[model samples]
Target: MTGSTVGGQLAEELQEIRERSGLSLAALASRTPYSKSSWERYLNGKKPVPRQAVDALCALTGTSAGRLLALWELADAEWSGRARPVSAPKEPQVPDRPAPSPAPPTAAARAGVRWWTVAAAVAGVTAACLAVLAFVGGSPDEQARTATEPPVRNHGCRADTCEGKSAVAMGCGAAGMITTLATHTASDGRRLELRHAKLCHAVWVRATGLMPGDRVELSLPAGRTQSVTAEGSLDAGRYLATPMASGDSRTSTRICLDVPDRHPECFTG
Candidate 1:
């Protein structure tokens, strides 16, 4: 098989498998955690598919990995000087790449080495890691609740500070949730939070503290913008006057994408 032929065949097979599974390009992208554009490039034969990517595609399509590996071998042989028959001497070990490291606990590692000590250490580390992960990773649904709950405020809400105004304020509380990143930091020290509902139409926002003349603008992914005026060094925070529509809300923001039919947390502007 020629290089071009192999590339074309691999792409075609992948696309065929995806279609057979009744998945659209975007759906496949969602399942794979890769971008839609990335999927398009791989399926178009415009780039060499990574081995892991191939394995993932095969698994997702319910195809056998062994057959795909065989195809890869054929492609490798064609690229080399040899144009051997598809069933010719198998060169699983491509000469260009270095050999992969052998699995641990092989004869080499076991030779004249104490295994019990290493095993004990490994067990201890594994246990510790699991404990830490358990403490850190909370259930997503629970987290959504904790974040949406109103933030605790010790003061009141009023529009004037220059007039020496001081009182407690009341407003809805919200929390932001992002599916793409494990943790997200607001660049401008601000975030939007919304009540978690089956169908949340809009988010409310308020700047907690603003100087007499402090002004901030809200930006979201896809060039959405809103202007907010801070009232007299807001002691509690300002609440969003209206709901912000979904879509590209910020021109310069690239942190998140609005997945269709999914509830989105108010991302930082």
Candidate 2:
């Protein structure tokens, strides 16, 4: 099938799964990392569905991702056709100089002009050499400082500590330190913890008292967010956000559960 046809088929399948799962657009958005408008575009084929979004939908509906991914590969291949070769820059044409004076100039005047021209050429060359030296040498202290600096230390638990441990348990929370930034309870009485680790410099939310298929979403200021769904009758789930810098005062964190008729709970860091 053509790439567009394959993409259309993929979109149709995604919509079918969502409908079969009996979740509204808002509910899907609440349970997944994507926004409602993004879901709309993906379903209608107005935009390319991201791989992560595809995986999330498959997980939510208990559908296998293999077929969807194959369609995506075809669509992506069509979207990214062979790159066109770049053309080389055209060379500049030098304008012809006026012919030398029909009558020869005086010897003294010619000598003076030649001297000035040589001086200007030397000055230009010297300036270029100085610029190169400045770039290559920098400041001695700056060079020494860089040379003597130690390698950056890796954060979070390593070796046995991380074995069989959940991401949060291994000190991979926001900022790389397992600090609880806030807590909230969902309308359904599930407890949630907003965690930050200094080393990872990212935020995540953990929800407890969940049931099968329950989902949790954590949104942070500046449009960072994550979502995860419960599996296998588990009572807990966690959603992790992208990495961020530590100690930003401008952003707030929010958490929401996909339970019906519930609003998001928010806290400022």
lDDT per residue, candidate 1, 41-104, as tens digits?
8778776554445655664565666677677555444434234443322223435655476644
Worst 10 residues of 1 by lDDT: 162-171
* TM per candidate: 0.28, 0.33
The CA lDDT of each predicted structure is 0.43, 0.58
**Candidate 1 RMSD computed on C-alpha atoms after optimal superposition onto the true structure:** 22.0
lDDT of prediction 2 = 0.58
Q: Write the per-residue lDDT of candidate 2 for residues 16-112, one digit (tens) a residue.
A: 9888989888987655546789789988887767655776677657576677878776665444431234343333464887757887568998778
Error of 1 at 268 (Å): 44
Candidate 1's TM-score = 0.28
